[model samples]
Target: MHSVCVLGLGLIGGSVLRAVRSAGYPAWGATKSEGDRDAALADGYDVEASVEDALRRAADEDALIVLAVPLTALEEVLRQIRALAPSCPLTDVVSVKGPVAEAVGRILPSVRYVGGHPMAGSTESGWAAGSAELFRGAPWVVTAEEETDLTRWAQVARLAIACGAHVIPATPEQHDATVARISHLPHLFAAVLAAVGAEGGPLAWSLAAGSFTDGTRVAGTRPELVRAMCEGNRSALLEALDEALGRLGAARGSLASTGGLAVTVDAGHEARRGFTATPQAGPAEIRIDLKDPNALDELLDLGTLGGRITSIEDDLAVGEELGNP
Candidate 1:
């Protein structure tokens, strides 16, 4: 197993450290947060004295470096990586992929880097709130581009699998566009919904039920973190936001004219049902030979069709197609 070094020991970072360690891989982490550093150290995990120290060790060991920092902190972290471990195999758990990929390309063009985003998180923040099981069974995307190093990509995918996540191979553009709808848009909606409900005053707060709680849960995430995530993918988020507003406008107009929300309510209900419905048949197995010249293309195509890699054995990538036929 390739040793791992994680920079940023909060939430996702902390969880990655814990999960990788549990999987028997040698792992260590560093963070700028003194509280998180102390807490992780007290829990018996190796917490480096500083980012520089962590990077130096990673360089010496030729360990895979995982960037778990927020988008705002990404450039600074990348600069350190460039200085200390310019040639280390690298990956990240950042929420938005395009901007990170772009930054990496500009800053370390020759570095063996793969972008990743684990589609799992909590409304809570910080090291203490994270669990080793947070990513279990979640869809963790690994960006597959034309220039991606297959060996390094496989290493990153293996680590994700060992940490109990199914890997989704996607281009950074595809990942950003898709997540804008499923993830970032939801965060924005949650924020709006929470604010709107709160404006209903004390009576609304008293009558808050499961629907309200569930809908607004992500609105409770730290404001700075939410801002960084939503703002980082500006172009994609704008497109998703525009579509949402168009639907909302139509719904409002219908409600005002017809005094009925049937169209809006029914459409949402059907979409929700479709999302929750299980497949009647088992997923179809998919295999991609890593040595094939078209392997990266095949991986991206599989992800585009909602396939996920369960594991990689030697040169064979074993996956399954879960989307509708």
Candidate 2:
């Protein structure tokens, strides 16, 4: 097992450190927050005095460096990594992939970099709210661009698997576009829904039930964190936002003119059913040989088809296609 060093020990980063260490891989982390540092240290985990110290140690030990920082903090963190451990194998658990990939390319081009985003989180933030099991059974995307370093990709995928997530290979652009709809858009919707519900005042609050609670659950996430994620993928989010607005506008028009919402309601119900059904359906097995020249292409195609890698053996990746019936 490759040793791991994580920067930004809050939430996702803290969870990664806990899970990675629990998996029997030597792991250590660093955080700028004194509270988080003290908390993690009190919990018996190894935490360096500073990011520089952690990076220096990672360089000496040839550890895999995981960037768990927010997108707004990414550039500064990348610069620190470039100065302290320029050649270290690098990966990230940031929400947005495209911007992070671009930053890595520009700032640390010589590093063995593989972008990653684990689709798991809580409305809560900080080290205290993190759990080792946070990513269990989640879809962890590993960016598989044409020029990606397959070896480094495999290492990052292995770490994600160790943290109990299935690896989904995708290009950074694909990851960003997909997440803009599924993750970022939902956060925006949740915020809007929560605000609308609150506008109903005390009566609405008293009458609120499962639907309202579930719909606005992510609204509880830290505002700055949500802002960072949504803003970081501005281009993709704008596209998703436009489509959502169009749908909502059509629904509003129908409600005004016909006094019915059958079209919008039925479409949404069916889509929700489909979303629920996909994971329950049995998956078909898929295998790809890493030695093949087109292996990366095959992996990305599989991901587009909703495939996920369960494990890698030698040069062969064993996975399952979950999208197709």
Candidate 3:
């Protein structure tokens, strides 16, 4: 097993570090907060005071370093990692992927960086709130770009699986587009609902129940974190918002007519039924940028990428598809 080290030991990162350590692999956490460092030390876990020191330790151990930080802090973190541990196989748990891949390309061109997003968390946060089971059975998305190193990509996927997550492979762009609708739009809607509920005065507070509280639970997440997430993938989020607004407008029109909202509500229910069970790992996919002349050669060299070539095309000409491996 590759040694594991996590940067920015917040909720997600701390949980990952704990999970990795519990799995019997050596793990270390790098934190800027002295309080957090002391707290981890008291818990009998390895903690580093600086990324430089952490990266140095990772370098010595040839560790897979997970950057579990905010989207805005990614570039600087990548820069620090590149300066200290240039050869480390790096991956991030940031929500957005395209922007992060772009940042990695710019800041750490030589380092191998795989993008990841674990679709797991609660309204809770901080190291104390971290749990080893947070990612258990969760859909852990691993974003592979055209230039992604397959070896490092597999390492990241294995790390996710070791954390008890189901690994799902996707391109950075596809991951962004899908999560925009499923994740980002819902967060916005929750905020909107919470805001409306807050404006309804004491009567609304008294009337609040399971439905209202459940719907608005995510709305209570840290404002700064939400802002960073929304801003990081603003383009995808805006597109998703437009689609959501269109559906809402249709629902409004139905509410005003004799047809009512039964169809709209039913459609949502059926769509949600598909998510009743945990999804299995679909397939291993490797996207090659045809724009590169040597891409075909690289594809031919990828021996164990067991996916069927259901669709063979570029990003501009055709869309990415999921098929058997």
Sequence-dependent TM-score of model 2: 0.94
Model 3 regions lying over 4 Å from their true place: 257-259, 277-325
* Candidate 2 ranges with C-alpha deviation above 4 Å: 278-281
Per-residue alpha-carbon lDDT of model 2 for 146-216, expressed as tens digits? 78878888889889999999999999999999999998999999999999999999999999999999999
In the predicted model 2, the residue pairs found to clash are none
TM-score of 1: 0.94
TM-score of each: 0.94, 0.94, 0.80
Better of 1 and 2 by TM-score: 2
Query: lDDT tens digits, residues 8-66, model 1?
Result: 98999999999999999999999999999999999999989999999999999999999
- The reply for model 1, stretches above 4 Å from the true place, is 206-208, 258-262, 323-325
Quick one: ranking by lDDT, best first? Answer: 1, 2, 3
Predicted model with the maximum TM-score: 2
The candidate scoring highest on lDDT is: 1
What Cα-based lDDT does every candidate model obtain?
A: 0.93, 0.92, 0.78
